[model samples]
Target: MTAAKTETFTSLAASVLDIEARSVSDLKRYLDANFTRACECLLACKGRVIVLGMGKSGHIGGKIAATLASTGTPAFFVHPGEASHGDLGMITSDDVVLAISNSGETGEVLSIAPLIKRRGAHLISMTGNPQSTLAELADVHICIAVEQEACPLGLAPTSSTTATLAMGDALAVALLHARGFTADDFAMSHPGGSLGRRLLLHIHDVMHKGERMPLVNADASLSDALLEMSRKGLGMTGIVDAQQRLVGVFTDGDLRRILDQRIDVHQAQIDRVMTRNPITISADVLAAEGLKLMEDRKINGLFAVDDAQKPVGALNMHDLLKAGVM
Candidate 1:
């Protein structure tokens, strides 16, 4: 690369690092009484947190609103410009408003401040300019001031936006902890996601049960067990005794080992070649736990046992992969 291009790239990188570092450091100054009051107000709010902003701040507010909603706080973003054009009706007396603007003087946000106050909603302004109109009119003000922007021109929202986003995350997580939100609650909110599948899908939900399960008697001949494994297409089969309780497991590996021993697959009994005391998982366990167990044991499959030690179901690595937990 040319020296001029290299110098320009190096300068940009240093500027970005400096801006982000200072933005994070500036957070310590804002985490005082004002931040405490903001958290308390949000915790006390019986309704949703209505986030409002304009331009670049509006984009940041949308992400903050989504983060809050997913982390146990009910929240939504409203464009300040749109709020004046009939969107103001979304705000009620019971809600809390979080207005974002780096300068604290964005015309759209300033225009809506009086109406937000008239609606009896608590206004919390996040801005770099504490003495500006929006901050002065707010019930609580959060300072997101930055020493400089990453842009060489010093006019972009880089550092200020980062600070605002981090502060919003801090608030959301604190509220999540105070509300005693659990993993199950998070799963409920994200039911269609992979996290929900990992937390909510149980072994029983994915295991092969009834006639779909592959099985063979412990006294059955090796040839018959091989037929069972082939018929079921699970690459393995459970070996049970007269009481219908699992005694051992026969797999493709066992077939290879028996062939290595020169044992007659047609004449040898499955009990003699099957794996005794095979590892099993409970039917009630989560699919995530089952996946972990398989990983730890270095096995591709496991039998699901009932409380009475009966072979209730079967599962394999393919099942977990298909379920999106792999």
Candidate 2:
């Protein structure tokens, strides 16, 4: 492209962004009793929120439904075109229908409005024109009007779609707060994602337990501690007392320092070289917290202890990395 064409493209992109931003900002004025009623209707709904739209609005509706479903609201999108061809059976009397149309007179959406009403389902319309047929027939009408389209010809759905999406997000977030939705709750809906791993994975779920735990008695020889560390492959061993209470930890880093001193590994006692009163974590804490602790303490290994400070489990930076906690 020529320099003048490049400048024109950049200017057009900036104008689009500015127009879309203003459209969303303008929606704040429309958050009146209708928005509150929309939230209340959704909260009181016993069945899923059935979102219906066509074309560009349908795409936005699908995302809106997904956001609502993941944020403590039961929702799903039903394409208006599909709805007329047997998908209408998916809706029930207890459900709430969220119908979106930038023009407020989409034929496919309007064609099924009466059937939805006949089923006793509540209808909430989101439209750019409040006086349109859909708004008049809806139990609650949310106006998503934008002054102009970001398209230079004023024929595309750019600014209008942005406003509709923003309104949907506003409703989802408001309902999320009203329902006191938490990270743990959100994790339940997205258990396969990284956020779910961070919120739902506990230390006990990933730490090496039982015989996998690297441990040695406090009176054991340095060679014995080394053997346990090598066998467990965690690069560390816990030093415990006769009652099995963890008294200290000996790691590969400690070995490097001890080797520099020319210590006799065969005869040296573990207690003499061990780090006493080392930092520890409970098995019940989130693995993400363990990652933070490892970063903060500048250590790669940690012991998961019982209430009595007994080493019940062991983990290293490699273990966390393998478990997707790193």
In candidate 1, position 140 carries an lDDT of: 99
Alpha carbon lDDT at 134, candidate 1: 89
Residue runs of model 1 more than 4 Å from their true location after superposition = 1-4
Give the per-residue Cα lDDT of candidate 1 at 110.
92
- Candidate 2 least-lDDT 10 residues: 317-326
TM-score of every model?
0.96, 0.97
For model 2, residues 1-326, the per-residue Cα lDDT tens digits are 79999999999999999999999999999999999999999999999999999999999999999999999999999999999999999999999999999999999999999999999999999999999999999999999999999999999889999999999999999999999999999999999888889899999999999999999998999999999989999999999999999999999999999999999999999999999999999999999999999999999999999998888898988988888876
TM-score of 1: 0.96
**Per-residue lDDT tens digits of candidate 1, residues 101-217?**
999989999998999999999999999998999899999999988888887788877888888899889889989999999998898888789999998899999999998789988
Task: List the candidate 2 regions with Cα displacement exceeding 4 Å.
Answer: 1-3
